[model samples]
Target chain A: MAFSTTIRQAYQDELAGLRTAGLFKEERYILGPQGADIEVEFPAGADGRPVINFCANNYLGLSSHPDVVAAARRGLETHGYGLSSVRFICGTQDIHRKLEKRLTEFLETEDTLLFPSCMDANAGCFEAILGEEDVMIADRLVHASIVDGMRLCKAMRDTYKHSDMGHLRDKLIEHQDKRIRMIITDGVFSMDGDLAKLDEIVALAEEYNAMVFLDDSHASGFIGKTGRGTHEHCGVMGKIDVITTTMGKGLGGASGGCVSGRRELVEMCRQRARPYLFSNTVAPMIVAGTLKVLDLVFASTERRDRLEANTSYWRRGLTEMGLDLKQGESPIVPVMLYNAKLAQDMARDLFAEGIYVVGFFFPVVPQGAARIRTQLSAAHTQAHLDKGLAAFRKVAGKYGILGKGKREIMEMYGK
Target chain B: MPIDKQMILDYVIREYLEEDDDTEITYNTELISGGIVDSFSMVSLKRFLEKKYNIQIPDADATPEAFDTVNSIAALVERFVKA
Candidate 1:
């Protein structure tokens, strides 16, 4: 009859089991602004240690940019704080409309509808357009958010092998009986740091007469020649039927997302997407900040070019150090260490050495596919990279994983 | 005289597939969803097959069903192999 015996006890046992399995995730607090370098307080309640950060999605290094901060401040002065209601209510401000317009231009879409986050955009977009007659075939490695979004929709859910156009084509053929077939994928695979091969995907969609849905969250700011997105990068900008992206990562790293694509589809989302209809509107500060971010990215390709160069430099450094890495063109660089314990231990030691990185292992990634995901930014300097590389060498030397790959790591420490 | 399927199976087991007590992988075992070879590893497996067999499996030919088993994988390789 007791609360402890009935509900709390079962939950406690599961939590304890997770801890025993070494799968429990702990939060490391960041004491300062997010950037290439940050002060972190690990294990909590400890003094913040300054470290060169290599695990942030702040790809453009504009999270704390002065101009963005100024723009946000101006927005606060003009528009005030919380919207307290959804966009349909009195929450729709001039700034919000301006941001939507700018985002439409930036993303090269007919229309755009803002969401609380890309997660919301993903959650809301599917049910808004598709129904029981439709089929949503997503890439296997699409982000978890997309999977959840699909689960919420009435459309029958299916998946193709990640970036496998052949599988996608087959799925298209299998589902031709459906009224609508939408191919969904992430513009950039966040964990593996690989691209979605949008060129081939678009070609397949065109051949099958299926619409395409892309979550450009990771590629929104620095992917294309001028930072339009994977659509522009793949030269299929206007052809995509739906694109869901976030301002939380590559934009200003504040928080906001949008579903941008065909005018009718976006309007459908605005009208019926549950999150859009229920959730409070994005803060005015974020709108102004993201607008500035758009201005900065659209003004020039300096940040994108720098990010590409930085990726090359970091990849070269890690490769030369004999650390096995995932082959990728994006800023997400994962240094392979097959064993979970080794990945965690190496990340802990790297933290101690004044370099901040996270160990991704089972549950986060697959078993025997553990690694330390190092994300590069235009904010990262040559000196910062040199220090990070030095720290990596020191930590990898400690673990004896240098020049070792998955097989070697597995041999050294059982998978 | 030609490439053996066991060779491909061994490489797959060694590099990608993780077999359990009841699910030992052989020539006909499903390798994509069944073998638990995730999409990321599938890419690596495709590359391995290409290099080992001296063939380039085009993206369109690298379907989940085609790469579902060692037999299908072998067939795919033979299709692209110079005869």
Candidate 2:
């Protein structure tokens, strides 16, 4: 039996609204390795040469690293390409064990468990651990995966008004008698390019007798002096209870994720977590590639150092241009534009100028919080950063956003 | 003793649970797998039961079977008060 005509019309009508509202994402076809410069072929737009990439999450410049590629090739030669089974069912290889151990040691955690993706790691965590009697306090601005995980767990869930320690304290007091309480937050908020106050969270958890869970997907590969993530950045590396991160964004841009914590907690999750227990394991080649990336991260600080330099150069240049960049040290820099249409227009203009950056608007962020989400990479050269900044200034000025310098041009319209 | 089962059900459906306006949930609504109550909704339900009924619900009673419907949640609430 075919569906009713009303059902078909309803779906089509809803999609039409999305198009009219300018919220539909236009996916670009990337034709090169993830790096500072990218080549994209658009089906609709005017054909042009390859544009520079400013939106990738390849923070450490290791996506196509020779060592990482070589390691993946070796794994392919030795263990074959894919593991058809889950981790417990003949999918756990020697490299997986070694990588997990090395991750735990590198993060200074008791144990670690791997997952197919960071999204899975997050979605599997809350349900595996929290019970109905427990209480979970989370930051309001955490990742969508963390929110989904919290939705799947039967714990008393409450969110402290984003990064407000006083509100967090009040919630802790209200749930003081709960069996167990966990404070969950992202190490680096993706959109706003802000770092969570880890010192404050750790201190609050101590006073409230709560466990802490930090999803450091954005900070994992290149934050601290040793690149150990938010905990190391905050100088509380051993205090946090759980650390979840993804290998897709960093660690050679391979697809994998992990959660590191107490051995007992890791064991419990392995047995009970729905996604980890049911899903296929990380491919042998990906695991080997990740291990090599980790080795590179530890051996030399060049990648991280270069990333920091690129971030500062871009941020300082953007700031000097009088653009309102969110104040943070993370590589994710958001150039705020209060109007969604303007942000989209600015992105289109930037594309015309051979720079590729994505504009984020409401629904992704709160309404009126639209901005260009510019991501920096160690792969970005001095010339690349300069070109990107120049493009941004030109586009932003064209929109009358650069202030009195463009005042006469905008006033000519007699608005 | 008389219990306000309607208020209890409404609280569970609106606040403790993520209810859909597209569907109607009677006092005897089954929550789990029916898409009425998820894990987060279950947590909120537990909190509501504890706060409104003034009873502590143990883990054993926190399963989908116990919170299957408004009747089940009410039944669990009743059991908690008795215990």
Q: Write one digit per residue (lDDT tens) for candidate 2, span A137-224.
A: 8887899999899889988687765677887888788899899999999999999888899999899999989999999999987988
What fraction of correct interface contacts does each candidate retain?
A: 0.00, 0.07
* Number of the top lDDT candidate: 1
Q: Can you tell me which runs of candidate 1 are displaced by over 4 Å?
A: A1-6, B1-83
For model 2, the docking class works out as incorrect
Write down the TM-score of every candidate.
0.85, 0.82
The digit string of per-residue lDDT tens for model 1 on A351-415 reads 99999999898767765678899999999999999999999999899888888876778899887
DockQ of 2: 0.07
Colliding pairs, model 1: B31-B68
> By DockQ thresholds, what CAPRI class is model 1?
incorrect
After superposing candidate 2 on the true structure, give the runs of residues whose Cα lies further than 4 Å from its correct spot: A1-6, A44-48, A403-415, B1-83
How well does candidate 1 score on lDDT at residue A15?
98
